[model samples]
Target: DQQVKQNSPSLSVQEGRISILNCDYTNSMFDYFLWYKKYPAEGPTFLISISSIKDKNEDGRFTVFLNKSAKHLSLHIVPSQPGDSAVYFCAASVIFSSGSARQLTFGSGTQLTVLP
Candidate 1:
């Protein structure tokens, strides 16, 4: 079963507009959330993270919001740019094992397009 899900498989937006991506989780025990941006050849989800301890986290043109009661989270990109176009992945944190690096469970991916 997919404990976490991104209901929308893709999203598209024009330049300078706001783009929103949504996700839902079935596991109430999951306390940490993240959003990762991926390009054609690189690895890493771009490492966007938010702790369940907080309701929201923001950085530059990106922001993430969480609702523990709803088991929902969303990522918003403002003034979407063509340069921002890429696949975005949603991941949740699992309990860490000793000496293990942080890992993520990725969504299939969402393709964001910023039309000029």
Candidate 2:
């Protein structure tokens, strides 16, 4: 019973192309969605986020789309660069600790290799 899953463990795309990562969630209570990017040794950093009320959110070269009815979400990076090579995690949570630490539920992760 996976509450969240990233079926594709990896994705490779040429530089200046587009990279798309997908995620699925089974919990209907999830209200917040987020994507984090990670390098080899560094901790995962927030890349983008979307609220349950919206269907799409974008920042610079990154975009995230949500399909609530399908319990699916995707992160899209346009003009993907060699620097974009890293792992991506899709996390979902509804119960954020009020005045406390944020607890995140992360997907397995999808390694994106942006080749030059």
Candidate 3:
């Protein structure tokens, strides 16, 4: 079974509108959650992130909300622009032991299209 899941395959929004993407996880040990944006023929670029200890984190037009009790997280984009079109991925990671490397587990990803 997949630890992380993004139920929506795609999303579309007009320019200057809001776009919302949802994700769910089955792993309770995951403490770090992140959102990444990927373009064709390019690597995923980190967008926003939130720790399990915090309910919400925001940066400019992007925001990430995490609900530990529900094992869910959501990414919100305000004033969505055409350039924001890309595949959005939800990832979660946990440190297994002290000074251990973090291994990120990614969701399938949701394609977001922003119309001008």
Best by lDDT: 3
User: What TM-score would candidate 2 get against the native?
Assistant: 0.93
Tell me each candidate's RMSD, in Å, in order.
2.0, 1.9, 1.3
Score every model by TM-score.
0.88, 0.93, 0.95
Clashing pairs in 3: none
Models sorted by lDDT, best on top = 3, 2, 1
* For model 2, the run of ten residues with the poorest summed lDDT: 95-104
lDDT of each: 0.83, 0.94, 0.95
Model 1 regions more than 4 Å off: 96-103
Tens-place lDDT digits, model 3, residues 17-41:
9999999999998989999999999
Ranking by TM-score: 3, 2, 1
* Tens-digit lDDT track of model 1 for 79-102: 889998888888887665663765
For model 2, the stretches where C-alpha displacement exceeds 4 angstroms are 96-102
Task: Name the top TM-score candidate.
Answer: 3
